[model samples]
Target: MQSDICTIKVRDCSYIDIEANMAIVINNCFISTNVFRVSPSVASDEQPLLSYSHTHKKWLTGRYIGKLYFEYNGKPHCFEVQPRFGNANILILLEEIFNIKLAHNTSEYKLYDNSDNELLKKIISIIWVKTLSKINIHGLPKHKVEKLNKSSTVRGKIAIKRSVLPIYKEKYVVSKRIEKEVDSTIVAILKKAYIILCKDYSLTESMLSDAVKEVIRVPCYNKKVITTNQFQKIKYGAIYANYKEIVDFSWHIIQHKKQSSMHEMADTMGDALFLDMAEIWEKYLFTILKKCFAPRGWHVYSQQYRIYQNIGFERSIIPDIILEKDGHVVVLDAKYKRMTGHFSDYDRTDFFQLHTYGSYMESHNKKLIGLGLIYPLSERFDKEKLDKNFAKNLYGDSTSNTWFKVDGICLKDSHHQLTEQKDDFLRRVESLLLI
Candidate 1:
């Protein structure tokens, strides 16, 4: 049945049993694991409308941003607008990451909030700008060559040694390395990205069209393998600050059609809007903690490999953020979901995970690690600052649960100044450090 809210028809389906446990995040939208099923349109570009689900009521309890893609009734299912309560703060963070201030408090922001269209546009703008500005700064990409092509120029100097063999001069003499169009995989990937974005009719094609002439000259990529080393080279390169983000976003969209991963939108749909809300929150926290703690002779690390399941190192438990100091170790877990102090099953799981991390850190270093959970301090949660304690060491550690608490910290509060929030958080963190 068509939902009354929008032009597109909304359908309901039984949410797959396996996916029922995970809050799938895609395109910066979150779909709850508890939802039975949602209705999504395949050709979002053609309809330019979002799906409405009857079952979203069950799991859509709080303000969580990011779209979730699911297949039901042989069609895609999604929520049109995922509530982003901390939009103001998140926009500020993204702006900082992009190194540019966008019109957040303006009408464009309103349009994005209401329509969910310009949100992706803003994301792509970051990618396009960062990509074009740095793509050629290092000069056209180069590759080593040992064979001669039809138009190959032989390096007479190097070829002189092999000139004794006639074929060496004709076939292998032009062994000199050169920067050519065909060898530049980066350019090929960039060109493909431009074309892929252009194909997605929903997006403002002009955004990519503007970049076509600059990157279109590179030859198409004939190889399928996208190596880890290639991305690392671009990431560590001295180019745009957000170049890695741009490259990652570009590659995901380019590869989206190829790998749907159940949560992925159909490549035939052609539009790509994906953001891992969880990762974003973690990274944002890392920046804040790293900046504040760096001057104080503290070290902050992400995915600190502190635990492994087996001696062979086959399984691992790498927490998002870890703070190491002379006397104290703090494990900060960043959960993207909005909370009101009423811990849900998911929140409990997070608490246990943080507890496990603490346990591991303590056993490894012979020191009790301070645990902290940081949730978004939105207006909804701000009202219900109900004095709540979620876990008293849910990991069977009853003796120390009460005295040594796992502090639950909320950040990005609209009610308080950013500095004030940081001060409050730091205070809480200090108390944890004492124990």
Candidate 2:
């Protein structure tokens, strides 16, 4: 027996000792700690008996009395064993070590001491070969892997695969920065050109189109300066007065993706219409006061008192205008509606509201000169008779002494002719206050 040279798998001989001269070469071996173990121990007396005896006797004695503790991977175990070196004994030992019974389907092996070192060397050699074979150089230093190509490569070609690898990528970043600068410069030039053209030609569609094309040719400039729909919106004051025409013209240049629906436009148009009418009336009123009352030293602040009551409930009331001069407070509420034959609940409510303001001022001992509800001309009541009736209704006939007097003033003319009536109303209010 040439030292009974035999190789065993690394798993088979997890624990083994070999002589230094007897070489063990492990190849491709994954060396890791075994999760299972077998503890072989003998009684003190049995140990002495085996130590003192001859080789065969020691073997026999050890086999007879030595205890083997089998601990499977991930499990705790203890057992007594008759330690023998036969194949059946080895199978039994392995079965106990792994907690699996030996069957005809399973293969088995035994490792003598001489073969242990050679098996280890074989394992180490195999591991070294595998590790070296798996050495990847693609992500390593320049000496390891070839440098990627920088020349612009077509799709599906493996050039510089990473963004950071190509020189053109840096060039692309630089080009983008240059393009942005150029675009900004172009836009500034275009804006200045547009302003110059607008100043010359008054921003008509043809002129605007020619101006834009002079800088950069654009399609659809010849169609219309202002769209038919946009013209209607501007004429009707559907948008703000200042920006309406300009915004409409801009819309023609850059068409909106979604135009406002008829319903949305109508709602917006209603507000615009009211504001337009309100502006007209506001101008008329200002003119009337300036012409009629300015000479009298009575400064009329239109839309003046926005009353906010802080003590009781949070209440807000805004009188149309407050005509004040020389310590007289003339509270005027403008009613667009005409006075009816029998006063409607709304009319009475307006009266009560004004009366409350009057009462509040009187109770506070403040100088509430007089309160007046001004309405448009009505067929139900004569203007002079209505004024007297309004005064009698507010202050009872010789029965009640209200601190502030409430009266109605009817203007027969349109807002443009309100100057004449405003003067008369101011004089009446002045007389009532004895000023």
Candidate 3:
């Protein structure tokens, strides 16, 4: 017996067509119009329609002509379907279909622009075909497929959990520790810069009144009582300018000549001398150190500052300067050398000497945290290895004095540039003092 004919219903209509054309089957009932050609249009110059018999798939209708509009799922999508020679028509069939308007000058005249269709297809494919199966199944039989699915689910959950948890807490802790160390180092360097300035300028506490007045005026001070520019003027007029005068006077005494008037020579000498005196370390570094550290409550001391000690060693190894703030000490020794290679056994010995200062502080109940070795700008030293060696030589272990450290700072051409302006010097000093 022949199989019972099955009828397919669309919308409110039923259709039965044995015709080979799928379009005829679709349109004969749903569309209710026999005269209309419901199949997609093609052009005379287009290729013949190719078909797969087994899969019942229709091939391109000739080379498509004009634009083709169709509905897929619930949305209207368009493709540019054009023959080698013809006007394009947009096809729109679905209810609530979206319209697309293309410019006449579009380059692809043969193919209907299906970019939007492709984009929708990709999104739908990913959602339905790719990701849908990944949804969690709360309960399942203990079959292999179920077990494998559960394992995948657990792995994804663990990954999400790790992503949200505390992997970097230790890194943050280390960073904070390093920052504190840097701050402490800066405080020490600034203290030393201040001492250098005071000694070089022969500045007493009373002498510092004018400098203080100028210092308070700086913008960083943030006080209406003084401006940085005004304070700089006072400091320049008092300390740095006077040093310039002394240098000029000394130069004039050395270069006496009959042709040039001594007064004229003195005037020329004064400019040169000022330039020369400004190049001095004590003048520039101290000013910079003061400006850099004073705002942070760091005190710099140079030269005459004394740290008396008896660490079973008879003689005191007085450092060039000591930077101190809130009871923390940073011993800084300045070296005037051309090449950084001059770190001799003597220099190493001197470092050991400074380590003695640290030992003294530890023994005598003082809060000595670190030591700094300051050199001219061109000099470079390996601070890590130096610190390691220092700890080993002095404390008998590479890490014994973990808190006690050594660092190097370079004061290059900043002295010459900074000495001319008190404020500039202070700014540079502040930067140099940074640990």
Candidate 4:
């Protein structure tokens, strides 16, 4: 029965039950343990997905969002990790970052329920869009298929029975014809994926109409469930390369199964797909900043390696974002954490890290213009009550002759369009870097 499945949903970096068996499952492979004791050091191999603090008697979650299903103590348990901002925001961020279309009005969808399947389907659909968009005029994958034919001359293997036919056959020869035909394996998998996402998962049909038309163009492409062995046996080459990610996501859908079959308790452990919020946050900031600054000849780079030699070895420092234009350089670190504009609210380590980056840039170049920390404005900061200047100039002492500043970017958009937030953020960043 579906009732037998126990699901525990938690936000990233939140606490989980101490009795829980913790594991980090990604793409189907997993590492799990029943109990994790707090130790001074954790070996790379011995690290558990959920770290336990023996002193606190709780397990701490990591930055991940997905479903993990396993049997512990003869009971089926599903661990679902969601983003701190909720499912809708993650979908919005993915749409913006990947430049793919997703369902609008995400709040109207079945997102509030405990089921992780909705989010999973949305992710699969996004992958489908991405893969399909890359297709050129060459269209779907095709392979050489051999067909027996009767022709005037020999082409492949001659058909003995057809050649020996009594009627008019002396002038005709039966041979095999090798023709390039659309690959049935790939079409079948994609069709099944579409049905699972649109029909079963209740994804809006219009959202995938273009993709549907693409699949429908394949003549007589039958939608059928593909077994694991069948999928594994399919060969991949350059022609079918773009379909790889969509197929993998479809396979994930097959493993999860429908709610009606929850009682079966199949050996399929289901799928796990997670995005690190910290990394996504960094990338999101980089993308927006680049869009706003790149038009004016500002070069924006992310995770750039700056290698320097220690006394005995080589070391490198990778700062999140670096903006340079005409030899004027600005070093900034994107912090996903909330900011309240208080000096004590800032982390000492983060301050030191940014300071180190600024010092390094200044030492290497004479024209380091600004050093700053860009953080997300807390949800509690009502956008309506705040002016544009509130987004920046949070706390700084430029009069002290150090162009170091703390800035906040509003992450929430009341209209859900993000136009205002993005515009404000761009203006704030430009002011900081131009100074």
Candidate 5:
């Protein structure tokens, strides 16, 4: 790894001298871990995003993976978090989430490198593709734009101030024409970004498809130089949410390119691009279960919140996944932890947490039929052993009772390729979560 770039896995730790590296500190003591919460958002008690051990001279990572950039002493530094299971699984996760294929290169795994630029670029391209696809569906958003044109005949409205000028006495009349056009700062930036990405980052028409590229065929540059500030403030309807996302990615691409150009920009603190792996796992499970259970009229919800109040105080508890079909309700928490199918390998905290969640649901919903935990099935773990251990954990519970269970999703095949056993995994999950 490069001296300037340090890489670690999610939920792992790294050695970074906090006293030596002052740039990581957004404030006096606290280091900013999230991109959005650059200033004031501190970690909640339940989710300790990041921490440092001064005595150990190490920075402990939370459940986040991506690249964070920091600058100190006129030098740029990067703190990267990767998945413990390696690049393939992370790629699969991204592909599934984005609903796009990110072609994998074998060279990436042969030797680890400092720059995660390739992965970052793939993500940017995928975002671009998604945005372009939406644009194709919604058509380019039209905006009312005013243009000043000089004509012999009067136009929409004569510019009184300009028409009265001495230079325009017997010449052409200056008029402002307000016309609706498929052009804006957002479109301009994305157009420029498309060119930059394709020319410099190997983003191809083949990757984005000819149809997607046709959406931005005509360059929308209105000769306006879009700054980072303008890019950040690009506005769009809440209905077309991808517009803002595309603009954000474009800005990142532009800034990254500028920063790579011989360090022309000043050393400054910037936001990091990261994804919560555990959240991704939860979302993946929710999406899969929703698809699998949709025909049966089951509704799947992610991060459903419930209030628990005692005496005068109230607390909120959120479960990862909840399913409702007819009058039956099932709550499940997706865990991205390492499991070895051993009886003692389970965490007691998870059991207690699920117990609280189940108890709340049982009391409130009366139709609550099940509660469960789901873990990823890796090549390192045995599914039969996991089932046996899970059954053993349920010691005195009746076999017929479907109140609680533990299950696994086969996320990888034996060869560690993309998952081909999703049907099997979904079947197991259905059997465990539903009676």
Candidate 6:
């Protein structure tokens, strides 16, 4: 299944009101004004919730991805969105996110190359093409074993289901199910993918048409049995080797089930689609930190919980990234936000959070702990100043060589190229921690 992002205008930005029925999910970056948060006339309990406010019209800015259902100027609307991250394009960010997340390159990697077109349609086309190519190379005949018909040579022992085997002794009851069954989980995924792609509008992929035609002939139904473990093995089939990411991405789209309807497909066309880019950045950075640190004999743990404070209610806190090697520990909180050119309350709050984490980890574990803010480098900041933005700051302990430090992770270097960004970031991080 491909994802579609909806574009909309709040039409009446000056004034608006809301009721309890309609809902919307906007990234924290997006404005909380009444125009930005709209509500629908119909009462749909399943809509994503949002707070309403009346404010002036302005450009929409938010990298958080999620679905929204609302009404503007008397008409209802539905959208699946991936909003831009600052001046950066959303699709490119998606490419970076997924590449880092999957950490594997498939033959269909080129599917993400074209950014000027519809992402969902192109992805659907690529999936169809890649799947058909694999099917052609390996042939569609799955090794389906049968117990009756006496049409093919026996591949299994004469196994029967009921006690009436005596009468049908001549018929070898092949109870063994091998890989060739059309109803196998892989084929079920394919059928489901086909239906999902079919529901998309304005598909230009010619192969998609052929794929849909042949999909109807597949002797299987969309059983909705695709599981996490089942998905991991689907790509290992002889033909799917190069098609791994495409199929895996398709699985991602399929997972977004409608809360209201079990049988309904993901809202790719107009109604439903979205992803949390904020959560994604935090998660992906954690993954990168894990991989980069592991090779250096550092152990990384994500969402490590500790008792920051304990009232009668027994509340706890979780840090996004925690790394330990020998007797040294690094506590980090990932922020998927751009720098404000100078420090603000946000930075102060973040520093306080990290300080709290360092104290908690050090006191209990009795190890030298350092705190860091991991943030993406954007075009708005002076790299030199931003790099040393923590120099005069309260966070940093050169005396003990462990305290608060600013990561200033450059997503792109002076050359403005992203290709070398990952390695450069890791090296910088290593230097920052090992120092």
TM per model?
A: 0.62, 0.32, 0.28, 0.59, 0.62, 0.57
The per-model lDDT (C-alpha) reads 0.48, 0.33, 0.31, 0.59, 0.59, 0.48
Which runs in model 5 stand beyond 4 Å of their true positions?
1-61, 67-80, 105-118, 141-208, 215-272, 306-312, 343-345, 380-383, 389-400, 413-418, 433-435
Model 2 misplacement above 4 A: 1-287, 302-312, 340-342, 363-365, 378-384, 390-394, 397-430
Model 1 per-residue lDDT at 271:
32
**Model 3, which residues run further than 4 Å from truth?**
1-279, 303-318, 338-346, 379-399, 402-435
Candidate order, lDDT descending = 4, 5, 6, 1, 2, 3
Clashes within 3 Å, all models in order: 13, 22, 25, 0, 0, 4
Q: What is the C-alpha lDDT profile of model 4 across 104-221, one tens digit per residue? A: 5545344433454456555556546555654523576777888986668678888777777822645787787789877787778766656666764545655554545777567655
Positional deviation of residue 371's Cα in model 5 after best superposition, in angstroms? 1.5
TM-score leaderboard ranking: 5, 1, 4, 6, 2, 3
On residues 54-101, what C-alpha lDDT tens digit does candidate 1 reach at each position?
Answer: 444332322223333344445545443333534456555554444444
Clashes of 2: 22
lDDT (Cα, tens digit) per residue for candidate 6, span 180-208: 45436656665665666555412344444
Better candidate by TM-score, 2 or 3:
2
Across residues 1-435, which tens digit of lDDT does each residue of candidate 3 receive? 112223221211111122355433222212111011111110011121222233223222221122222233333323232221112211111100111122234332123323222321222122221111221121111111111112212321233334333334421111111111112221222233234334322223432333333322332322232222432232222212322222222122222211122333222211111111111233234445555676788876654323534555444344555667767665555433222443431356655776776676567565665654443333334544444434322355455432333433333233333233434423433443443
Candidate 6, residue 422: the lDDT equals 57
If candidate 2 were superposed on the true structure by all CA atoms, what would the RMSD be? 46.1
Better of 3 and 5 by lDDT: 5
